[model samples]
Target: MKVDPDFLDTLRLGGEFNARQCINCGTCTALCPLGMEIMPRKLFRYALLGNKEAVLKSTEPIYSCLLCKMCEANCPGGVHIAENVRALRSYLNAEVLEV
Candidate 1:
């Protein structure tokens, strides 16, 4: 799929989030209460690489997050997991969903 080089920056416009801080250590995925492996780390990777299609395909998992911040507490990279998810949702709503 083609990449949208500015996708991450566009997503950031929706809200404040430090997704770039992610270390991809899978800590957030493991700590997920919902057992959703696609939750954060994967999504963040897609966002970082400007893989808009990948991010869009993960819409369900994005909204599924409970935003409990449990994963954030254990993140070695100090990524604001919940906040990033929120930003993704906002991006989808405004840019994709046009809501």
Candidate 2:
């Protein structure tokens, strides 16, 4: 699967979304306040799989994030939930039409 250079750069800059460490443990989802509705854990899985469509479709949940930093705090792998979310938001903003 070809990865998006911009997305990869975002991950690097965000200092999270550790593509190497994620084991699909669902910890991020369990800890996420939006999990009941958004399901970040599943989103992360889609991202790791390089499913850009799924990732983009999931952007609403990513943007809905309150940036509370709670998910990152509880992440055993230390994923930067807020930063990654912000990066995804930025990517979505640039890719989608405002209308």
Candidate 3:
């Protein structure tokens, strides 16, 4: 997938979540009871690298997130996981749905 290069910077403008803090430790995914299967870690990496298309295509996992903070509580990297999910939803609504 082609990287937009500016996607991450643009997402940061929302100031709701900080994906950069994530260390890709997989702690969040392991703790997820909802069986997220794909999420904040992989998605964050895509976001960090500005892979807009990859991130966008992950709508199922993104929207499937319960945002229960289950992952956030155990996150060793201190990533605001719920906030990141919310940010992704917001981005999709604004940029994809044009709401």
> How are the candidates ranked when ordered by TM-score, highest leading?
1, 3, 2
Better of 2 and 3 by lDDT: 3
Tens-digit per-residue lDDT, 1-99, candidate 1: 789998878988999757777878998888898998887898889889999999999989998999999999999988888889999999999988899
Please, what is the whole-model Cα lDDT of each candidate in the order they appear? 0.88, 0.65, 0.84
RMSD of each: 1.0, 3.5, 1.3
TM-score of each: 0.94, 0.71, 0.90
Report the CA-based lDDT of candidate 3 relative to the real structure: 0.84
Better model by TM-score: candidate 2 vs candidate 3: 3
**Model 2, position 10: C-alpha lDDT score:** 50
- Across residues 37-75, which tens digit of lDDT does each residue of candidate 3 receive? 577798889988888988889989988898899889988
Q: Which candidate is the best by TM-score?
A: 1
The per-prediction tally of clashing pairs is 0, 0, 0
